[model samples]
Target: MAVKIYGIKNCDTMAKARHWLEARGVEAVFHDYKALSIGQDVLEGWADRIGWQKLINTSGTTFRKLPDEDRADLDEAKALRLMQAQPSMIRRPILDTGDQLIAGFKPDIYENVFK
Candidate 1:
């Protein structure tokens, strides 16, 4: 299967997910959003697949640093635009497994999808 994981290298969750995949011998391409910018098309696709709430990482420092005005009243279009501008505002370890897309890493979810 063709699998690609997107996130920053230093992120703890990203590190864990990468380690998990490596331990299980699952090959995947890694896309560091910090180095490789995420475009509107890709952000929109992820939003469509998982919805804006799931795509946006409100818990991240990037999101917290945003102005209150920017964070308020978010819709799909606005969220996509913001994510395009600040890739770190999006959730980490977004996995594109050809057949499906998985956001965030959970042991049970990873096992079910990858194993």
Candidate 2:
């Protein structure tokens, strides 16, 4: 199966990840959740594989700007709602190799994935 990348099209990290894959001749289809909304089922599947905690981009401005009440007491359902409402709150460049899910862009990890 082909590699599938999920992220916002204009994200710098997404660009880096795409460039890295292209440089190595790795073909991947990018899913820009910003333009197209992500489904709850898809998000749930990812969460099951990598854990919901890893799916949320707590370090991003979207997350930081959230009211303390909304940010506090996070659980799978709450996190999913937050992410669905604001895709930017989700992490960038989530690489799905069909067999595994890789969150974020780490050169070494990506190299290992290709290898």
Candidate 3:
């Protein structure tokens, strides 16, 4: 796959990431979770590369709102299912650089990775 930035457009962090990439003139395909559907296979591939722990957005409200039981005892399969069911539960701006899978945004990390 080519470089893709998977995120929700309205997300503040996503906005920052977009601006960062735009300022750098880095071309990337955007996968807006709110505007389009993310396939199970896609999420699975991401999980394989990044690990389900990093892929899941535990900091987000969607994940916090889930029942304790639902969030409990999560493995790759369970986390993948939850993320597939609620795309918002996936970390914002997962940057696929066509070589590596970045699960979340960090300017320094981005700098090093993209540089």
Which numbered prediction scores highest in lDDT against the true structure?
Answer: 2
Clashing pairs in 2: none
Model 2's TM-score against the true structure? 0.98
Mind giving the per-residue lDDT tens digits that candidate 1 earns over 1-115? Answer: 6799999888999999999999999999999997889878888888788888898898889989999999999998888888889988889889999888888999899999965
The model with the greater TM-score, 1 or 2, is: 2
TM-score, every prediction? 0.95, 0.98, 0.94
Which 10-residue window in model 2 sums to the lowest lDDT? 87-96
Which parts of model 2 are misplaced by more than 4 Å?
none
Candidate 2: tens digits of C-alpha lDDT, residues 34-71: 89989999999999999999999999999999999999
| Candidate 3: worst-modelled 10 consecutive residues by lDDT | 28-37
Stretches of candidate 1 off by over 4 Å are: none
Note the residue pairs that clash in candidate 3. Answer: none
Q: What is the C-alpha RMSD of each candidate to the true structure, in Å?
A: 1.0, 0.6, 1.1
User: Cα lDDT for residue 15, model 2?
Assistant: 96
Candidate 3 residues lying further than 4 Å off, grouped into runs, are none
**For model 3, what is the alpha-carbon lDDT of residue 111?**
92
Report the CA-based lDDT of candidate 3 relative to the real structure: 0.88
